[model samples]
Target: MADRVVAHQGAACWATLFTHAHYLPCLAVLLQSMRACQTRYPLVVMVTETVDARTRERLARMGCVLRDVDAWRVPHADGSLAFERFQNVWTKLRAFELYEYERVVMIDSDMLMCHNMDELFDLPLERGMIAAAFACTCNPKQIPTYPAEWTPRNCGYALRPHPPNDARQLTKPTYRLINSGVVVLEPSQEQQAEIHTFILRHTERVAQYRFPDQDLLADVYRDRIQMLPWYYNALKTLRQCHPDLWNDGEARIIHYILDKPWLLGPSPCGEHTHLHSLWWDAYASLAAHPATLSMTRDEWANEIALHVRGI
Candidate 1:
């Protein structure tokens, strides 16, 4: 409930990524929700050259500081050093390079803020601390090895099988993976250098991970991470797969996972309809005049192709 401007007093700010023009609507809604909730810190967005000038102007008009960064990539899994399409997810790691900010809480553009989460800035974060909520294990039935007694405290590692004759398996430590959607990071020159070094040292392993940023970060900071309460990042999957854990009143930020309400119409049944309605309501209020920047049919096809390639 505290609305203190702690981040501004220090060097921190709220940051997110704007990689593609198609994401403009989501970013607009996210910014609108942040303003509606009266967030205390300035909102900064990291963008690549691919983002159009008009979108950049719109973001600036919305009072967001725009930062231009080069797109980054990791090697392909097959030990092939071929460069994949630019992945915005990899760009999330650049948050650590904003040395001007002592700390930053990176929120995905797909998220909607229901309350002023300034309290996140007050949470104790050590030099290497990465704070985030545990990704909802809503479909436990699908995970064959999921323990019936699973709780955040006892769920230390989730095993990943290695190929036969892979001696590298002995060096890897399995750790619980945290969702990268909402993360509290303390950015420093040293931390940035460390991440860069890590990427260079384990480029092959990073490329093979299903979720690059999420997996690599969890691997590096697994021991230093502090798990936040689920209310901080209530995943929509919980509402769809595990209704028992869904409570709108307790949720401060609703993250639309696999399915986004903006792109898809509301479902006909269940409480998830209400959650989707919330997203539409925010979108309708903020995206009255959506950005003109849009992908062409061929560009859209290319984007789909790139996604299929998992880059």
Candidate 2:
């Protein structure tokens, strides 16, 4: 058994998130990571969009609190992708200011903690937001890779242009482009009201946009949010950024969101088309974890297969 030490002593709490059944692997990896860290935070809450009977039983056995919400219930006008399903969950999380904890770190279910993050809460959100990385192209050469819709002006990347001569630009981007994977939020009625208005306005326009939630989050909060250290939502995107990440260092979370762990370990990019094994490894790990409740490999295969069929 791993040593169990509460990183926050007695006054800290954090949340690991998921939606529908796609969260199984993320939940398993998250719990195992927390266990490895020996974090003794009072509660480990799993936010989901209705868990199946099997998952509910499994989470209960692990002694994790499960909050089931209706994804469909989230206010949506057109329901493009309903990505804001998460924002609705955040509404529930933000309500916890009434709780005794001083900070709440919300993590996406598609991420894993590679190291202990006991010190993250210590960094106050006094006048800023906390996040892992920025969205879209960072390097000059990588600019063409993203579609125009994902560029700075289009509600995908930061709302500002990249600086030409600034070498530190990637390290400290000028605009607010928070990857929703890992965020450390301090509860404030002011912040929550802003967030609520942002969500409400986007909810009304989902019928017109393709990527409504991602669009709103990037566009609305572009100037207001703050960028945290990169390692927080360390994306497994490409090689250029990988070498800097130290397994024993400050990086707290690994967000394998796009090239999701369900399909691949790290996203296969460029000439790596032959590396389907990366995807296989991710699927295998999820299948092998003993703590995983419900939704077996066959079921996941079928689920993804359905996605491919439509594609």
CA RMSD of each candidate after superposition:
9.2, 8.1
Model 2: per-residue Cα lDDT over 1-311, one tens digit each: 32323223336667654444555545655666666667655335544545577656656666576555434334444434424444444334443342445566666666666667766666544343433346534432444323343432332233223212232443332343446666666545666567566666666554443334344455655544556556666655522333333242555665654445344434444533322334344444655654343445575455433332121
> Considering summed lDDT, which 10 consecutive residues are worst modelled in model 1?
156-165
In terms of TM-score, the best-performing candidate is 1
Model 1 misplacement above 4 A: 1-9, 78-86, 137-175, 266-271, 287-311
Give the CA lDDT, 0 to 100, for residue 297 in model 2: 57
lDDT of each: 0.67, 0.49
Error of 2 at 253 (Å): 2.3
Tell me how candidate 2 scores on lDDT: 0.49
Angstrom error at residue 263, model 2: 3.4
lDDT for model 1 comes to 0.67
Q: Write the per-residue lDDT of candidate 1 for residues 5-24, one digit (tens) a residue.
A: 33435777888877876776
TM-score of each prediction: 0.76, 0.62
lDDT of 2 at 176: 36
Model 1 pairs whose backbones collide: none
